[model samples]
Target: MAERELDPTVGALRGEDVEDRDWERVQPRRISDADWKRFEGYAAEILRAMGMPLDTPGTAKTPGRFLSALFDSTEGYEGDAKLVTAFPTECRGGPDCEISQVVEGPIPFYSLCEHHAFPFFGHAFIGYVAHEHIIGISKLTRLVRMFARRFTVQERMGSEITNALSRILQAHGVALYLEAVHLCTQMRGVRESEQTTRTTFWRGNYEATPALREEFLAIAGAHTNGHRS
Candidate 1:
């Protein structure tokens, strides 16, 4: 079977205007005061239709609060400006030059499932072999959160992160692993409380070399097992 090509537009870190990007269909739009008022009214009506009492003082503002929280949670639509920057690699050429995987892990993230709008959250482990540059350590977390904050599926999220890292670093390899507990399953449908979803993505050399993939997995597993080094 042929390997799938990574979406070149998956990560907009190159300062590309993402308004028309297919991967990020939910473009940021102006939400005026009138829009908020209209949304709050709709929320209240929806709650009432669902038999939620909103007349009580405690519940009176629930609709507005709900709207605010929902919008706040999906703020990934507004891309992070800090993600656009990268620093030159410290790896020196010559006999001393040593290229290795750069891994950042246990990045806790919360995301709403596009299927149900219920939250599925967990930690992400990202590994990449830099070519000419390296991203800031903190930006890894932002990268994960960028996709997570949207209504997304785990598979797509992993792909976007992998592709984004590859694009930014022009990396030789990129690997991403995500393990999340979906409330959609726990709170509805089969109600499998203990079930968690795991997804992985590999690109470039990470996809070509099994040992490289395994090495990345080992590091991620060690951290997950609480043996951080």
Candidate 2:
């Protein structure tokens, strides 16, 4: 198991802002039986090599559980990021049609550490300004989860999420912040536990304009350090 915590401040949107909003949960596709069988066999072999007695009642289901978790962490498991059906929403852009809207909150995520295959889990903060379109708050959260539930580096994950949103929504700007505690670092190497690794990605106005970036950080309550777009 991995230590994953979302800061209470992640979803700091005002009550009225989220109320009346239809937040639909994404349904996960089922993993195939063939894949499950293969993974179970492999996991059992690894456990046997690790000196685990698989015949024991308590241990019998460990391999299946481990395999299930590994696949579930990726959400789609054998597929790509789930397709998001976004609806048309009114944007309150000014005369120039430059609208600044931000959806900030904590979204739970977990991933495998490429270095050691241990799990790293934490929260991600996302906010964006709109040009012609504004995404629903629920979609933003789903997008973050879709990207986070895959095997990738935190830096790349942040970047990928930003790019995906920008392309899908064609927004004027986008910003993302990820903070996670890696089990690989906690249980091995230097064994540091208290510190967290942070990664950020920004694009369009949030990248070219310092004020916009700062405002986003202020809203998301993110520390502006080690930013990568």
Best candidate (score: TM-score): 1
**Cα RMSD for candidate 2?**
11.4
Clashing pairs in 2: 10-105, 10-106, 11-105
lDDT of 1 by residue, 1-229 (tens): 1112222334333445343233334356479999899999999999999999999998999999998889989888777766645666755544233237888888999999999999999989998877566877688888888889989899988877776677766667788989888998887668645787888898887777887789888988888778323
lDDT of 2 by residue, 114-224 (tens): 667788888788877765456676767677766667767788677767766665555668888788888877776576456788787888777787877777767666432
**TM-score of each prediction:** 0.83, 0.73
Model 1 RMSD in angstroms:
5.8
Question: For every model in order, what is the number of clashing pairs?
Answer: 0, 3
lDDT of each: 0.77, 0.67
Which parts of model 2 are misplaced by more than 4 Å? 1-38, 77-83, 89-99, 222-229
Query: In model 1, what lDDT does residue 138 have?
Result: 88
